[model samples]
Target: LGERVSWQTLATVLIGLLGVLVMLRPGAGLFDWAALLSLGSAFLYGLSQLMARKISDTESSTVMAFYQNGAYLTGALLVAGLFRLAGIEHAVHPSLEFLVRPWIWPALPDLLKMAACGFVASAGMILLSQAYRLAQANRVATFEYTGIIWSPLWGFLFFAEVPHSATVLGATLIIGAGLLAFRTERLRAAPPLLVPTGDTA
Candidate 1:
């Protein structure tokens, strides 16, 4: 769900939206800078993936998987910490003092929702790792594109946030490209060896 294209593509779209706002407003330097930073990060990630594939032949797949998982976990922790800190700084405690104050811990429902989210997230990670381990890495990674196809559908079904026609079209193109690339890589990685004349009839 997170991997495929949603995580990066969605972030890129949001940053693009911010950039639009910055363009429309005269004094939005900070937003402009932030948007550029986000765009640059996404570009670098794409380049990094290309570089990784170039070097992958030299590294054990298991080691690569470990590093990938470790990076995911580290990113998750950082995001969680950032949100938790935001909540604390906003004095979102639901104690008596908070009740007396204007800031009440967003709400009991929100807190419960966060806990449920965390549980689901942990389970998803476990399942993803298991899935990766059970299949060839390239094959598993190929299927990750399905998440890109499904994300907008999920968003529309759950939040009534209909995706743009352009988004749907773009995702379809990307999925097709991913399939083609996967097939090409698979064939190249395990090309059939030829027999010598002595072995042939």
Candidate 2:
């Protein structure tokens, strides 16, 4: 665990965070408090990327995906069981309710829909595992910023939710940060120019 983040990398991250803050407008009284949870999730996801890279030499992507899904299923069931035992009948928040809801049998269509979600999740996990396996975690991780573009697009398509102007600005900064990271990483990885032993001119 001798990881050291350079100031340049830290600055790139801060720029990305600035973009998010611009979008969120936390000082404008419009920020959803739930985003704090997302910040925590981002930290954990970074740790997972490092762990995935560390283990990539010995494990196949499919194996990693399998275990990831298994752990998720186990953790979810444990949480649901504990919630049931605790007799928490109501969650004040919709998201919390989704998490602690009692399990029940569903119609075939509902079941199939849930199964499809599981399949997509497993495929996504496999792809993420492959990404970390094939690249430096720091460099590869920056690509996650590109995902910010999709959330707005999906909201527009599915929910008819129009993105605010700040969303556009934030998305631009986020994508720009990713591009800069890639360029920086590429430059750093390139061989240094050799000093001329003697000037031919």
Candidate 3:
């Protein structure tokens, strides 16, 4: 099934993406390969949301989330094993270390924290899947920009970190873009005004 995106929606999407770039600020010396991975991940996520829309009528959100998490677990194990087999030194880089690090028994507290994280992730996946099930992909996707605002709030609350001016500005842009997209969608969905055939002279 093909869905056509309106020009307003496309413009707002571009604005939202621009805000993401501003927040990221990738440059020659400052760029990391991980940023590209993040971009690729976003693209894949959008694709997934679109695909979810097609199947949302037939498949339940719980089923979608189950398969999604199952894939994540399988991929993680496969990548970790491949990296370990390649004999990559853990000290090579933080990313490499993450991949090649040997599994160890964790303290009860650490295990609980990890479990909490998994719970939150699973809940989020279910909610997002349900959102796609209920609405157009573009409409749901635009609201993802709200994460820019939440990230800073979370960092401030949990890490005692203060956001820089650029972060604030970028977040503002993202929020604005989301609002614009919402307005565009609402206008598109609104019924056209009915005018009387006879006009007053």
Candidate 4:
């Protein structure tokens, strides 16, 4: 906790964030209120990851995953139930409506897909917990940028979506940022050089 942060580490983080901005292709000069929601989510995520690293020493990955998944399920159900009980229906936009819509029994195929997602999510949590446990959080944290690359890759593979120039550039930057972080950390950890100031010992 008392460790000093090096400028190289800050530069790597800034580079990664720049890559994210490049990937997003934000509208020029227009502040979208919806973007704040993403900021809020990011803040919460930071807190979660911080706590994950803090307790990782004593908690098994399995235990952490169980607690996380349990809390997620409980919170989701409670929020949905409250919305349902309030009889609030907003049907203007399909996306908005989806948020407030009453819960319905999903079809068999949809249910199966949802179940599979739950399993995948739990597995992801377990893996995430292990990651924080095994390495310094800062060392592993920048790897999260890879998710941006994965999204476009998956789109191309499954949905026939073509990635644009910005996406390519963004991916390159993100990758370079990670490599820079790795290289910088290695340099810092390397043994100090010994030099002879005098001709005779």
Q: Whole-model lDDT, candidate 2? A: 0.80
Residue by residue across 19-125, what tens digits does model 1's lDDT show?
33333344533444445655686576545444445445575444555665578679867865766656644433323133233335768899999889867766655
Considering TM-score, which of the candidate structures 1 and 4 is the better prediction for this target?
A: 4
TM-score of 4: 0.84
Between candidates 1 and 3, name the one with more favorable TM-score.
3
Clashes of each: 1, 0, 0, 0
Instruction: Please write out the lDDT profile of model 4 over residues 89-164, one tens digit for every residue.
Output: 7755443467786568889999999999999888988998898887666766677777789999999999999998
Strongest candidate by TM-score: 3
How would you order the candidates by TM-score, starting with the best? Answer: 3, 4, 2, 1
List the candidate 2 regions with Cα displacement exceeding 4 Å: 1-8, 30-36, 191-201
- Pairs of residues at least 3 apart in sequence or in different chains that clash in candidate 4: none
Model 1 ranges with Cα > 4 A deviation: 1-34, 40-104, 119-150, 196-201
TM-score for each model = 0.43, 0.81, 0.87, 0.84
Query: How far is each candidate from the true structure, as Cα RMSD in Å?
Result: 10.6, 2.9, 2.6, 3.0
As for TM-score, the candidate ahead, 2 or 3, is: 3
Error of 3 at 26 (Å): 3.1
lDDT of 2 by residue, 1-201 (tens): 345666667667777777877777677866466667778877877787788788988999999889878877898789788888888888866665776666788999999999999888899899999998886666565677667778898999999999999999998888888878877878878999999899686
